[model samples]
Every structure is written in C-alpha cells, then in structure tokens.
Target chain A: MTRIEEAIKQSKFQDVYQKALVNLIYTANCLRDEQVRILKPFDLLPQHFNVMRILRGRHPKPVCPGEIKEVMLDKANDLTRLLDKLERKGLIQRNLCPTNRRKMDITLTQAGIELLEKMNHMMEQTHETLKGRLSEREAASLSHLLDKLRG
Target chain B: MTRIEEAIKQSKFQDVYQKALVNLIYTANCLRDEQVRILKPFDLLPQHFNVMRILRGRHPKPVCPGEIKEVMLDKANDLTRLLDKLERKGLIQRNLCPTNRRKMDITLTQAGIELLEKMNHMMEQTHETLKGRLSEREAASLSHLLDKLRG
Candidate 1:
C-alpha cells in the first residue's frame, strides 16, 4: 500500500484508477499545506500569495482584475474581496484606467514587489524540498502523466 | 511544451522540477474544478461532500469535531461554521456526547447517506473520465511518483 492508502486507512481500492484518484487529491492537499506553511509565517494566504505572483508577473504593466481572474490557478469567486484585503495591506493599488474611467487597473506596490522577491526563493526552496526524492526524469514523467490525465 | 506551459503562457521553466511543481498545482486545481462541476447541481461544495464522506466512513459510530478535523483532506480552520452549515442543510446532526456534556458527537443523517448513495456512482464515473487516458500500469506509476514527490 502507498503512503496515501495508509493515511486514508483504505487499503482496498476497486482498481488502480480509484487508487490514483485518491493519491492525486491527497498529494495535492499536501503540496498546498506546504505552501500554507511557508505563507503563514509571512502572514499571507495562498490566494493572497497567488494574487501577488500574478501582479509580479505583470510588473510595470498594470493588469485588469478580469485578466488576473482569467489566469489565477484557483479561481477566486470573490476576487474583489481578496483585492480589498491586499489593498488594505498596502501590497497592491488600483487606479482608474486612463482609457476607460469606469475600469480600474491593478498594480503591485513597492512593498509587494519586495515581498515577493523575499518569498520567491524560499517558495522555490520549499518546492525543491518536497520533491527531493524525484529526479529530473521522474519529475518530467510525472508532469507528462498529469497532462495525459487531464486530456 | 506541455498544455500547462501554453495555459500559463510561460514556455520556459527553470527546470523540470519547477515545471513539475507548477504542473502538479495546476492539474490539482483542474481536478478540483471537475469535482465542483459535478457537485454544483447538488448544491454541495467539495468540503461539504468531504465531511459527508468522513461521516459515512464512520457510520453508526459518531465522531467528534476534532477527530473529523484530523482526518480531513483539506483542514478546515472554522469547522464549527462548516458543521453549522451541514446541520442547517439537515445532512448531519450533532448530539451532545452522552459521556461528556462538553463534547459533541457528529453523525450523518439518513438524508445524507441517501444523497451520497445517489452521487457516489456519478462521482466514481467522473473519476474514471478524468483518468481515462492512462492505463492501470500508468496510473500506478503516476501514484508512485506522487508518493515519492511528497517524500
């Protein structure tokens, strides 16, 4: 039995398909927990960190809220609320779009940029730590399988 | 380049490890979205369904809120709120532990069991659909790689 099978306390699966489903969800949760652990010390939620990453990726050029929503890994139904919290933290700012008065353009503040720089390396390190057992070939194989699974 | 690379529009990853990290998170979110699509019509969130599954697993034997938290795939910080929602939905009932007045014992309602029974086969079918591309050996290989990744 795999570690996930042991953790869920269900040794018998109807098939490998069911076992793989359970394992995927379980490992994903673990990966998310590892992210939460890293973000917790920084007083950030994964969603919060995710928003920052989006902004950082589009640094210098402000992005519209809809654009961020389109690319967010986990869709936040109430992204406005998350943006409000980030705004309150002074990590991001919204400006009236020059071309359209009704639209707002969102950009990262200096603090947001600095914060992401500080956290980015640590986040990468955590990923490396969690995936230490897998070689490059293994990692690629896993990615390929995931792509195939989605197809 | 994988579908993830195109989706994120970032064709170059720092390495295979980094690519795998992004792929894992992205694919996990996709899996969750698939689950949400299935549960939406039933007026259930994944968390609610998860709680029900836990209760079903321990049917006839009531479990404590703390015990539920420990075994939950996605740890809910405000379990009381979730319990309150479930109670309102009439899917679960909380009884004061006979042995300890301060403690509460949680169990699924008859309605909950029936609802799960109705959805269980569909849920399993959705799992099969999502993983249809992979053979049993491939599924096993993916699960094994995920286990190693989490090590």
Candidate 2:
C-alpha cells in the first residue's frame, strides 16, 4: 500500500481539514486528465490552449510576450520557446513591437481562431459533464473558497 | 487583452468556466512551486517525494515497480527513467522479485527515510500556510465538492 493508500485505509483524519487537502489535489489531477483528453483531439496541451486564449482576447490588438506571461495560467519557464512552437505550427504570429525593441507582439492566426471555435463546444461539453456533479451555487461557493485559499 | 482576459472582462459563461479552469491550474501550479522550493534544498521533485512515500509505505516488504505506479498520485510516463534517477542518487534500490520474473521490487534506503523526515515538516508547514485561508468546514466542503465534481 502507498502512503496515500494507507492514509485511505487508516481513516487517519481527526477532522475534515486534512481530508480537504488530499481531496483538492486528487480532484485537480482528475480534472486535468479530463482536460488532457479533450485537448488531445486538437493537438493542443492545456498550456497551448491557455496561450491561444490569451492571444484571441487581444484579437486585433497585438500584445507582447511579457504581458501574456503575466496573465498565463501557469507561469511558464520559457515563453520564447513555447511561442516558437506555436508560431512554427502557424497558429500564431509574432511581431516586434514598434515602441519596445525588446518586446514582441503575438497575435493568433485565422487557423488559431478557427481551432479555438471548434474546440469551444467540446470544452463546454467537458465543463457540463462535471457540472452535473455540483449545483451552480455549490460551484460558485467552491470557486469562491478556492480564491480565498489562494489569497 | 488576451482571450482569457477578455473572457474575464466579457463575463462569458463559457469564458467564466475557462477562467475557473485557469484558476485551478494556476493555484495548483503555485502550490507545486512551493513544493519545489521545499524539495530543492533536499534535491528532490514532487514526483520524487511521491516515490519515497510509496517506498516508505511498504517499508519492510519490497514493492514492485508496477505496484508503485498503481498508487502514484501522478501517473508518470517513464517509470524506468525515474527509478534509475532515484537509484543513482542512492535513495532507493531495485531488485527483481523472485515470485514474479517481470517484476522489480523497490526499497528505500536509510538516506531516503532521513531525507523524507526532513522534508515532511516543510510540506506540513506549507499546508499550514494555506490552511489559514479557509475555515475547517469550508475546506471540508470544498474537498467534498471537488471529489463529487471529479466523480
């Protein structure tokens, strides 16, 4: 038995607090699995999806890599490398910002927009699949609690 | 604005859901960041910590690589590589199981145990730091809801 398994077998929680930590980590892992499957069909990882979404937000207006990094869901180690991959795939275009020599503006290509649109329904479907397990109020409360936890 | 930022700015329900997804991913990333910091001083990663705990669970009795994978919180792609790293570090030993020709049993070294003891306190401290954000009941409910969502 693993320590996790042992923990499960032992029922060692004196209170609900400890149990919550385990549950949070476990559920996040489970949700990630689901997201990964959905993303696989698009040949995209979650991080890629995140980047595309960021670029699409700026749509006509191009934004620099530094800004994207700031808002990125996960603070990626190598923005240049990740952007290079996407640019090589022709999903996005990178241009040098006129005002800032060091900053490069990134914009999604038409293919990227279309890909996101195609994936949007599936993403919604995935969310809905999990939604049945909790009420709106419960989900809202849960999100609120998570935010508080982070804060 | 990035697509995600616009999603947040626009309050699109689908976008909101995506934001929630990002929030979960980001928060977990931050938690791992903390774990990485703690583990770094000991020259470990979260996955390594996971392996050590598994070995400790089956302390006296050796466990097979397959069994370790079964209980690992993160499903690793290459167990052989990970085991090799641990073995090279002198933290674990692998022996072919007598009963099962294909199976290799893994056991932790005293060095592994001592390192784990030192790191466990740091993990608990990190958890405690986050614990202050939510009340005990809220945490339990959050866990319950997350489990239900995953299910």
Candidate 3:
C-alpha cells in the first residue's frame, strides 16, 4: 500500500483540517491518475485534454496562445511546446491571428472534436465513479469548501 | 487576474467547473510553488523533502529505493532518477545490501538532516499561508470531503 493509503487507514482524526494537506494532494493525485488512464487510450495527457477543452469552450471563436495560457489548468510555461506536439498530432490547428501578428490563434480540428466526443462517456464515467463515493450534498459541499479554501 | 479569477467573477457554471479544475491545479501549483521557494534556499524540491522525512522516520536503518517508493506520496516511477539526483547532491548515499545486490540501501547524510532542520519551521509556515483563507473548521471539512471523494 502507498503511504497515503496507509495514512488513510490509520487516520484517527474526525476533523479533516488535522490532515488537510495530505488529503488534498492525495485526492488530486487520485483524480489525475484516473484521468491519465482514460486519456492514454487517446494518446493524450491531462494537459492536452485541458487545452482541448479550452478550445472547445471558445468554439466558433478562435483564441490565442496567451488566452489559452491564462485559462490553462496547469499554467505550463511550456505550453508552446505542448501545443507544438498537439499540432503535430493533427488534433489542433495553429494559425496566425490576423489582428495580432504576435499571437497565434488556436482552434480544435475536426479530429479533436471527435476525440472529445468519444471520450465524453469516459469522462462521465470517471466522475460517476467518484460521485458514487459521496452524496450530491457532499459533492456540492466539497466544491464549496474547496472554493472557500482558495479564498 | 488569472483565468480562474476571471471565471469566478463571470459566475459561469460551465466555465466555473473548468475554472474549478484550474483552481485545483493552481492551488496545488501554489503550494508546490511555496514549497519550492522554501526548499530552494536549501537546494531541494518537495520530493527531496519527502525522502528526507522518510529516512528520518527510519533513522539508523537504511532503506532501499523500493521501500522509499512505497512510502512516497508521489510514488514516482522515476525514483531511480530522483534518488540519483539526491545522491548527486550529497543529501543521500547508497550502499548495496549484503543479501541483495539488486537493492541498494539509502541513508541521509549529515548535510541532509541539517537542511531539513533549518526548513522545518518554514514548512509549517507554508501550511499556515494556505490555511489563512479558511477557518480551522472549514479546512477540516474540506479535507474530509476530499478524502471521501477519493474513496
């Protein structure tokens, strides 16, 4: 068993604050692990999924690399390199923004949309699997607490 | 403002979830950012800090890389590389076990312990800075929900 698993098994604290740090890191790792497994079949990483989602959000309206960077979940400094890899895979397109020569506009290719559609059910399943562990009320409270924690 | 900061201001639910994902990523990034900052003065990453803590837990008894992997929060597949990095920095030393040539025993050097000692208070400060936004009770609840969500 992992140290985190062991920590969970042995934890005596009813108050979560007592071990909030470990718990947050542990849970995020678990969520990311699940995402990695599902995304692997598509030859994508979590960062790639993040970029694709952002593109899809701005569908019909092209966005620049700077905008993508502002919204990226990982805020990777190496996004240009990551986008280069995605562009190489034909999952996305990069075009020069006519208005701003310095900015490169990014959009999802047809292949990228199809890939996201195919993975929709898997994404739902991943959330459903986790949702089973907590009630709706619990989930909302969790989300709320997380937001508050970030304040 | 960050994408998440803007998303929160816009109150976009779909954008909110996307931002929430980014928030989690950013929060983790921030914590790691602080950790890195604290560790830089000592020339260590959080992973290195973890290794030192593990070694201290089993002081006087050398641990193998495999044992360290089991207890590691990250459980990195590249432990060999991580160990190599630490060993290169003189924070840790490796000796082949008498019974198992395939396994090497790892122990902390005096420099490693002193480094950890110097940064111990700083580590607590890292947690304090993060918890500054939430009450103790809220932090505890957040931790609990995160753990339950992982299950």
Candidate 4:
C-alpha cells in the first residue's frame, strides 16, 4: 500500500484516477504544511511569501495588484488586504503609477528584497529536503506528469 | 513549455529538482482552486467538505475531533471551531462518549449524510474534470510520483 493509503486508513479506491485525486490533495497539503512551518519563524504566510517572490522575480519593475493576482498560487486571496498587510510590514510599497494615474504600482522595498534573500536561502534547503527522495530524472518525470494532469 | 510556465510566466529554473518543487506547489493550488469553485454553490469550504467526508467514510462509527485531525488533509485547522460550525449547520453531532465521559464522540447527522451523498455525486464529476486529461496508466503513475515525493 502507498503512504497515502496508510494516511487516510483506506486501501480501496474506485480507480487509479480517484486515488490520484486524493493523493494530489493530500500531498499538496503536506507540502503546504511544511512551508507553513518553515515560514512561521519568519512571520510569513504562504501567500505573503508567494507575493514577495513574485515581486522579487520582477525586482525594480513595478507590478500592479492585478498582475500579482494572476500569478498567485491561491487565487482566492484578497489582494488588497494582502497588500495592505505587506505595506504595513514595510516589505512592499504601493504608489500611484507614474504611467497611469488611476493604477497603483507596487514594488518591493529594499528591506523586502533583503528579507526575501534571507528567506530564499532557507527555502533552498526546504526544496532540497522535499525533493531529495526523487532522482533527477524522476523529478523531471513528476513535473511532466503534473503538467499533463493539468492539461 | 508546460502550463505552469505559462501560469507563472517564468521559463527558467535552477534545476529539475527546483522545477519539481514549484510544479508540485503550483499544481496543487490549481487543483484546490478547482475544488473551491465546485464547492462554492454548496456553500461548503473545502475543509468543511473534507470533515463531512471523513464522517461519511466511517459512518455509524463515531470519531473524535482528535482522530479527525490525524487524518485531515489540512492539518492546521482549528478543529474545535470547525466542529462548532458543523454542529451549527446541523450536519454533525458531538455527544459525550458513553465509555469515556471526558471525551466526545462525533458522528454525521442524517442531514449531514444526505448532504454528503449529494456532494459525492458532484465530487465524482469534479474528479473526472480534473483527471480527465490523464489515462489510467498516467493517473496511477501520477499517484505514485506524489507518494514518492512525500517520502
């Protein structure tokens, strides 16, 4: 039996597809839990961390809240509220766009960039720990399968 | 490029291992978003639906909140609050355990069971939509990869 079977205490599935659905949800929660533990000490939720990464990825290039929402892992988040929290934390700055007065342009503060750099180092260790069990080929294969599953 | 690349708007990764980490988290969130959309009309959050299903899985056999926590997909829930919500909705009942006065035994109400039955039919359709892209072999392979990843 797979670890999922043991976790849910159920060995029977209607089919492999059904089992895959359960396995995906269960494993994803496990991954999110690990991230939550790692982020707790840094006072960051996953959504906060995700937004920081998106900003850092486009550092020096301002992005609007709409763009961040498009790329956010959890689409259900209240972007305005999240941005307000980050702005209060001094991790991000939101200002009227120079190009379009109606739009708000968001950017990472220097403090935010530094904090993300520190967090990035820790996240590297986390990625290693999470993916260490799979071989390089296996990791690639896993990613390929996930992409196909989403198609 | 994979659908993930398009979603995140990034084409580069440090390595396959790193790519896999992003892929897993990203794919999991996509799956969750789908669930959220489907569950919305039922006025059920995923965690609520999850708890109801757990109750149904072991219908007639009472389970405590602690036992439910052990098997929940999202382990970080404030279970007591969650139970209170279910109880308020009249979908569940928590009775003082006959054998152990200090403990509570939780079970699904007839209303809860009936609701879950309806949800289950809907869920089966959701599962098909989510996993429909993959063949049987691919589904099995995907589940195996996810289990291996958690290891």
Q: Best candidate per TM-score, number?
A: 4
How are the candidates ranked when ordered by TM-score, highest leading? 4, 2, 1, 3
Q: What tens digits encode model 3's per-residue C-alpha lDDT throughout A80-106?
A: 999998899998999999998999989
lDDT tens digits, residue span A47-134, model 1: 8998898898879899888888877778788999999988998999999999988778999999989988888877878766756688
lDDT of each: 0.84, 0.74, 0.73, 0.84
DockQ of 1: 0.59
Over the stretch B61-104, how does candidate 2's per-residue lDDT look in tens digits? Answer: 89888877776767787888898989999989889888988999
Per-candidate fnat, comma-separated:
0.72, 0.47, 0.40, 0.76
Better of 2 and 4 by lDDT: 4
Please write out the lDDT profile of model 1 over residues B20-129, one tens digit for every residue: 88888888888888888888888888888888988988897999998888777788899999999888989899999999888899999999899888778779787667
Q: Report how far residue B143 has shifted in candidate 3, in Å.
A: 2.2
lDDT, model 1, position B142? 92
Supply the global lDDT for candidate 4: 0.84
lDDT of 3: 0.73
Which residue segments of model 3 deviate by more than 4 Å?
Answer: A1-18, B1-10, B14-23
Off by over 4 Å in 4: none
Report the TM-score measured on chain A for model 3. Answer: 0.89
TM-score, candidate number 1: 0.88
Provide the clash count, candidate 3. Answer: 1
Predictions in order: chain A TM-score: 0.93, 0.88, 0.89, 0.93
Ten-residue segment with the worst summed lDDT in candidate 4 chain A? A69-78
